[model samples]
Target: MRQLIIRAMATGTVATLALGACSSGSSDGSAKGRTPYIGVILPDTTSSARWETQDHPALEAAFKAKGVKYDIQNAQGDKAQFQAIADHMLKEGVNVLMIVDLDAASGIAVLTKAKQEGVATIDYDRLTLGGHADYYVSFDNVDVGELQGQGLVQCLQGQTKPIVAEVNGSPTDNNATLFAQGYDSVLGQLYNNGTFVKGPNQSTDNWDNATAGKNFTKMLAQTPNIGGVLVANDGMAQAVIAVLKQHHLNGKVPVTGQDATVPGLQSVLDGDQCMTVFKDSVKEAQAGADLAVNLAKGQTASAANAMVADTVTGKLVQSVELTPEAIVKSNVQDVIAAGAVTKAEVCTAQFAAACAANGIK
Candidate 1:
């Protein structure tokens, strides 16, 4: 498998990153009377809905408003496509490069090349291990996972020895690793104490929904008593819910998700899912855009919210880490108030009465 080969070949060492003479002149804004260019690459559309609906628009708006040159594209989960995009951008000599890496190894290759060309680079949303990026902007991924674990525990409080299945994000993603760390910290104790049954826990392939569906179905088959499901994001949770529905356990089982997406929110209202962790994409997108623009202008992203310690390289990278909030039926309206999702999208005819009761509008 590609995973095995990459893991075996991963160096985990900082690639030689000497930003040669390709530096963008001064830190004021324009470089040599020319507007700076920022190149951004998102991982894929299937990983999450926010990539297309939220992040892309916000990023474009930010750059357009600032009157900067930018080229943003989704790699569509293909490393070759990702490489081509990066090559094209580099050929145009972009001043700053930002990426949501599909895999750490491939991402490292891009960042390494950018560094060699003296282009400022940022690890956006997902951290690409062993890459020399100037900064990282994302939600506190470990905390995001912790919230999921805690939410599952709270959702099954009264149940005695309830079985819980975990549908985690792709193992190749570093953020997914942090999330697992957070949630497992909460779920592991209960499972060890026999307070809850830890059923099958599987990681989806590249955060794919179909893979999650198959994993969830397999878990349910092995442990039919599963009453709580901890899913990494809304997309995979939707797939799990469908399988649950087939088994007539949709409303009865508690499922956790993130991304406060329309479908995820509707599931909470319909009692088909427990809660979703709402990491506002606007905040992340705007923060990433701000950082990228600063870097493009030959400035550092030190104004970022925090300094992230890279476990692999043992170096601190400038970072902006936003908090992720847990969204349940009780406070799902808050997501609407924050404008992460429109009332029109979640308050459909089928969910009309529930939306009204929950003050979604």
Candidate 2:
């Protein structure tokens, strides 16, 4: 379960994001006149559809603008295959390797090998450790969880004995740990203070929706009067809601989710989900592309090569973190403004009335 990112201060213009920080390399990225090639390795083809549906497209667009070529691969959740993917990309002479490792441990081994070959490696979305990965790029997950907790609390609206259930993401995902930490900071306080009682607290592997649905069904059975559910992401939240519908409990219980997926937004409109965290994947993908291009050209990522001790490995590594937004019915327009989703995507015929009532038009 990845935690939610808190709102970041507006940095003025969108392009100004370039000046923030870099994952690795020097300030200028690479040297001049190098048309470097990049390799993007994804963990799996599941969870949120944004990786293929949104991220790949946006990243390709960014790379095209820089006159760069990129090769993208998916490991399909296989450990050996992930390492093989990295080996193949490295053998292909890719200047930089960007990976969204589904299996962090195996990914770290891949990065270790890549580092031996002088290929700059980035731990994308999921952090890979082993003194090999050069940089990390992801949302402030802990803050994202905090936002979900806050949103759920507000949705409950003074329910003194609110009963809440938590459905976290994959246990293998360290991001889930960070997210749980963030959520605990908020809800843990209430739970400890006797204002809210936690019902079922479980972690879903692979962020699988069906798995989430089953776990939620069992959770609802354990606690028949669930007031709210804190699901790690929109994908899992949708599954939880589907189970809720089985008990005719949909829309009656406020649910929290991350990832402003199309279905997630529609669920929000339909009143099945209370809120979701919108991490501008395009922005994140563009940033990764920029860093990859720079690294491939033999330039530094940016002047900011600050070090942070890894919680998992205790090794210092370069990092660039982006803040995620809290998306609810009231501020769904912000997501549209960011071009994260199309108006038509959320304002379909079935959602026409809800969209209008929410002022999404």
Candidate 3:
């Protein structure tokens, strides 16, 4: 079955075509093959800002260096729109399909349909299970959750017996479960030890900020003396932080987040939020694009030493799992240096003094 998939992918009649043998000799670190046209399907722009601000540009730049043409489409938070975009790209004859898989069910449906037509799929940043996705590329998601939990613990170290609320990401997302496992692994130990009290834990839907805001408000109402919050990402963290601000508890209670978004970084610098996790998106985007080009050319992700264990599928799938770094006020510059966000964006007018104090200039 794998051989048949590879052979069909090599024909490149559906999406893009990989041009050569699977080798490490390509200048851009891709398999030795002709440049292949690539298609990228991102989930809603609202779910996470990183999709457009970071991943899109990084993927485009990486593909350009590898001599590949790329087409991109954003679903804009609509499942029907996501499916339409995938169908359109398939019709356009892209050799490979790389998607962020906002709604795994909808994304898998598209991927499964594409696979039947001899087009390969790469799950980008988010995994697409229950469907035959050709490859996966992103940070170790469980590690991301563990980082959030551990960071919150460290920030709450000197406090008295504290109450913690967990504002996790979309419930439909399998990664959300992985994140909770990581957080629970650490926090559960703390809870068992009686050092921390867990309270008001719930996962958001579609990672929507509005949903996160309402849930956060309810969680706060339920746990009046909450000491910290383990928010899954920057988006949900911002919503939670806004509610904290209303109660004058913004900087008082420590919060953990991921993606190191602009508001999250500013909150960290302003002492409103505690920290965030910064995934090396450039490396991830390049890895995904390289895999897409490789698969399009009939090469294997194994050629790049990228193999991943998919507990969801009970198989070792083709993938590259990158590491994530914790970003606090102390190391916000590291995220800037990583090009996750520019100094200009992070050090705006309101943040000028904070930037100068931190030597960000």
Candidate 4:
């Protein structure tokens, strides 16, 4: 899988095909008098702000640019709603279906049904562990975790034997597991060498920020000297930061996050968060859109250059694995330049000086 992903990155074929499709101007790709349509089911809006704020618009623009008929809906974190939306889309005669599954069970059920209906299925972000999908599009999630772990290590460079607590994402999300694996691989070395003390490690339910805050609070109470935190994403990081602030340890202890949301960037600028990982949603959306367009048009969808193993089935699934970047205070402006966040959103009155200091105009 790593070799395939490296080959794809080296060749850049996925980006070329996706970009070419958008500019081709051959809108109608239907066959047998059937109107080609794509259906997209998002997992939820709660886990990260990216689903609605980034992925949705990026996907809408991509589909519109290709002149494809499509429907995009969010399950709002409800498994039943996710299934209902998939059933309705299938009933409406969609030729391709893409999803960011809430869990393997719910996603497997939806993917299985779509396959039975003869529809092409793509796993958008979260890959269903046992489910079969024609293609999968997501960032290299383990790499994302490794970056977070490295960021926390960088932040605690001089601290001797600092306790590091981990606030991981939802247990049900496969990405979370992969993320933990990545970070633990890095942090484990420090723990083994006695350079860092391991503290409480817990996963939040549904990536809930409130639950994360509660979990971190309990962990802090149990071990009050936690010098660093390895949080899974920006939302949960924000929760952990809140707990740190309650104890007046906000900027004193370093925290790592992902998604590079406005709050996360602001936190980084203000020295509250040590770092974040930025995954280009526009690029991801375009890749998925390109695949759906090909499937909808009855054309042979270009095979993604990468592959990821299905942990449950032990089969490698074709995948479009995008690279992720780590963001620190020195490079916060890069995210704004990449169009992930606006300067105005991240550089409010409270953060104005920090923005200016970081060269963010």
TM-score against truth, every candidate: 0.90, 0.89, 0.89, 0.95
List pairs with backbone clashes in candidate 4. 29-297
Question: Compared with the true structure, what per-residue lDDT tens digits does model 1 show for residues 1-361?
Answer: 0001111122222211213243433345443334589999998888788887778887898788777789999999999999999999999889888999998899999999999888889898887878878888788788899899999998898999998888999999988888888899899999999999888899998999999999889899989999799999999999999999999999889999999988899999999999999988777877777667666765433533456777678677766677789999989888888767788988999999999888776
Which is the leading candidate under lDDT?
4
**RMSD in Å for all candidates:** 6.9, 4.1, 6.2, 2.4
Scored by CA lDDT, what does every candidate get? Answer: 0.83, 0.78, 0.79, 0.88
Task: For candidate 1, list the clashing residue pairs, or say none.
Answer: none
lDDT of 2 by residue, 1-361 (tens): 3322223344343223233343333334443333477899877657886777667777788877777778988787788888888888888888788998776678778788888877888887777645457877777678888999988998888676989999999998877888888888899899998899988899998889899999888888879999999999988988888888888989999999987888899998888999999988787887677667767767545413234446666776655677789999988877887777889988899998988988886
List candidate 3 segments past 4 Å from native. 1-35, 303-306
lDDT of 3 at 71: 94
**Residue-wise C-alpha lDDT for candidate 4, range 60-121, written one tens digit per residue:** 99999888789999999999999999999999999899999999999999999999989999
Cα lDDT, model 3, residue 27: 36
Q: Tell me the tens digit of each residue's lDDT in model 3 across 181-240.
A: 888888999999999997889889899988999998998887799999999988888888
State each candidate's clash count: 0, 18, 9, 1
> In model 4, which regions exceed 4 Å deviation?
1-10, 16-24, 27-33
Best by TM-score: 4
The local distance difference test score of model 2 is: 0.78
Model 4, residue 281: distance off in Å is 0.5
Q: At residue 31, what lDDT does model 1 achieve? A: 36
